[model samples]
Target: MKFFDVFLKQFRLQWRQYLVASLASYGSLCTGMSMGWTSPVLPQLRGPNSPLPEQPTLQQESWIGSLLVLGGLIGPFITVPLSKHVGRRWLIMGSNVPLLLGWLLAGVTTNLPTLYVARLAWGCATAMQFATVPIYIGEIAEDKIRGALSAFFLLFINIGFLLAYAIGPFTSYWGLTACGGIISLLYLPFSWYLPETPFFLVFKGRLEEASSVLQQLRGKTKDEVQPELDSLQAMIAREYEEEPKISDLWASRGSVKALGICVFLAMLLQLSGIDVLLFYMEELLAKVGTKISPSDGTIIMGVVQVATSCVTPMVVDRLGRKLLMWTTSLGLTIFLTLIGVYALLDNYYKYDVTSVTFLPLLCLIVYMILFTLGVGPVPWILVAEMFPLKTKCLASGICSFMCWLAGFIWTRFFRDVAASYGIYTAFWILAVCCGIGFIFSVALLPETKGKTFDEIQDLLNNRTKQGNPGA
Candidate 1:
């Protein structure tokens, strides 16, 4: 078949699956809005753009930026258990409802408490995104294309952030938020049409439905899909035979190892200081003597981030996950070190580096480029791919919770750290963490590049002792 026809053929039956994943990503887009809104909106609030009775104090401004993490703290508890019971589609639907409400609320509300509630709502939605959307996409995707599709989740998120960065400056705060609500509305139909994963259907003893879904998603006949159905039945039978308890997640060596990898990656993700770079782009740029205006710097940063992230979906399956992880982590370590060295000389030693004013911008651009290449998207993909079916939801939820916890702690304290110790200190800290992450990830992260769900779990569980396939 011609490549174009082959591509069309792939989508003919699996279009709905792809559509659902795309739809689910709008939640991430809204998340981008939540992330980018604060940068522009904070300046407005400090002035007289909205109905805020007065300019916010520095403490309040910090809270406004970090308060979303507070909502992240609560989302998984509500959706983790709920997703297992109700369904990924509805949970996704339910998650976005709050996003819509939060954006709408932020668009209109004048009260500080109400504004705080809106941030919390956005946080809750973001947490749920990390918990559920990836699981849905992972379960539905064929292993060959799964990496690319998984990258879509991050792609939309960056797009959302870019939208806010690009448009937030030009529009009113209310108008920017209204755009967020519209994205939620656009996603609803796609979510409405999404099918439950065949794995979930089979586990529920809906064998016929599972068969039908497999046929549809695989673009194959019922006869062709029966073997897959039978495999699910066998897997389900084994799962029921030896169901894992929540308390015993760590009892199994493989489970513990898998969870460790997930959590470690999560910590590495935030510790890289992307959040600080993004959240404090304006302040950091001005302090670093970047030649560009802060607002333009932020927009440029957002654009670079989005552009670089686009490479992943194309190269992920082809180049594989491990390469991206270690290379990018090491790359981040190097760039961050450059940034730290520059800032240290410029800030503490009173060295006039004005001639190299563009150095910080060069380092930041490289930092984001390296970040989007792997560390930004791979951890979430790993979370979705590594866990056994029995513990998938629970493991993903817990890891997401911890990831956000890291986010919360960093977002809340990084400013203080920068204020007291200097941004150089923060940069150096991030460099050390990224360096360690590069080492650990290279040493420990198992490759899941082209494995089916069964194959991935089996590799993790040590069932098919090919003596370490990734190595």
Candidate 2:
């Protein structure tokens, strides 16, 4: 009863902030799933029976997919700075416009060129939303509940993934477009209810506005809000006392290492073969001899993703980021290695083929669970927490760009690798990458558990003294 009361109290106090964060977070999920959900349908879309134009060759389809990923690579570098200048609310709201437009075009277009253009636009908008939502969530949440709230972002992302996976298998192009439109409509009313980031408002010298926003967010009266407001002002004043310049990101050794750490982590997460499974789950399952319908595969994968993501918010703060990442990497490496072995046995060795094939499917499910728990949630949490205020926006942009670049590389090449070297060999390569990631986490990653933003800044700056350059 006491626990329930506290839960209710927190909800009542933070409901508005929660609603905004949830919606913005959902936008990111919708965007990622919008692209990912379409992957399963691509072969059909390009088949002779497709309602659109004549089908392209597999190679041409691959090239078009690469273009969409390239758009994601370029978007963050453009949007992050814009958000810093224009404010989070406007930038987030603006991102949805292109997404909506892209889906509209995709659903109606009869030509492949127009479809490619629509996907490129959708990628850009999705990347923008992904890069900004965390910054907004981190800025608005109270320190006590920040971790939980931030984890909610991952929860929504998994929810979107699940929805896409389930819906994409059964829905036609028109149905997918309608779903995208619904997500867009939700964005307008949801974003309107959001209070501006107090940090951004205060930075603009709108103290009164900042105070009111902060009070409403905390569900407190002015008297209760004053202490937090005063603390925020002092923190901002100190941050600006040195007049941080954009160049500081590359100039200072600490900042440089901080940027490197974020970029490396982002790259590691993508190369872990998680997205390969996400974007090509149905195809991947078929390769391993699990010949379930695409719709069924998608539903299974989605449920696993959501279940694991739900577990993350509970364990993340308690177990700490470094441990979670290390554990995830280790688990991924083992599962992937086992998957590779099973593939080889089933396809080449042909010894006990039935066992070999079925075992790999089970391992793949395990891999998904491990991924959701560690890699999926931990990387985003680290990216959100690792940077100091002065360089956060710039650093996040760079990191997100690197992430998309890695995604582009993986998506572009995974198909060729599977075609030439075989699925088993590809899984082997991912296993090796996961092994390398585990080493990196242990040697380079810092434990940011229980630290405030300022303390994390100090820790990041004191890297050399700690004898860890990556920290």
TM-score of each: 0.93, 0.92
> Which candidate ranks first by TM-score, i.e. highest?
1
Q: Which residue pairs come into collision in candidate 1?
A: none
The true-versus-predicted C-alpha distance at residue 377 of model 2, in Å, is 2.1
Residue 355 in candidate 1, Cα distance off native in Å: 2.6
**Tens digits of lDDT, candidate 2, 1-471:** 675577668778678777767876767676766666555567567666565767777676666566666778767866766865788888888877777777787777887878778778877886786677788888898765666667777777778778777777677766766786776668677767667899888878889999899877877888888888888889888877785677878866557767877788888878998767777777777776554665676678788878887766656665777887888899999999988887777776766766444566678778878877777777677677877676777778888888889988987798799889888999999999999989988888777776778767667777323322223
- Looking at model 2, the pairs that clash are none
Error of 1 at 173 (Å): 1.7
Give the per-residue lDDT digits (tens) of candidate 1, residues 58-170: 77877877888778878889777786578777788888677887887787888888898898889898888888888888888877778877888988888887888887778
Q: Candidate 2: where is the Cα deviation over 4 Å?
A: 1-13, 46-48, 251-253, 463-471
Superposed by TM-score, candidate 1 places the C-alpha of residue 398 at a distance from the truth, in angstroms, of 0.7
The weakest ten consecutive residues by lDDT in model 1 span 462-471
In order, candidate lDDTs are 0.81, 0.76
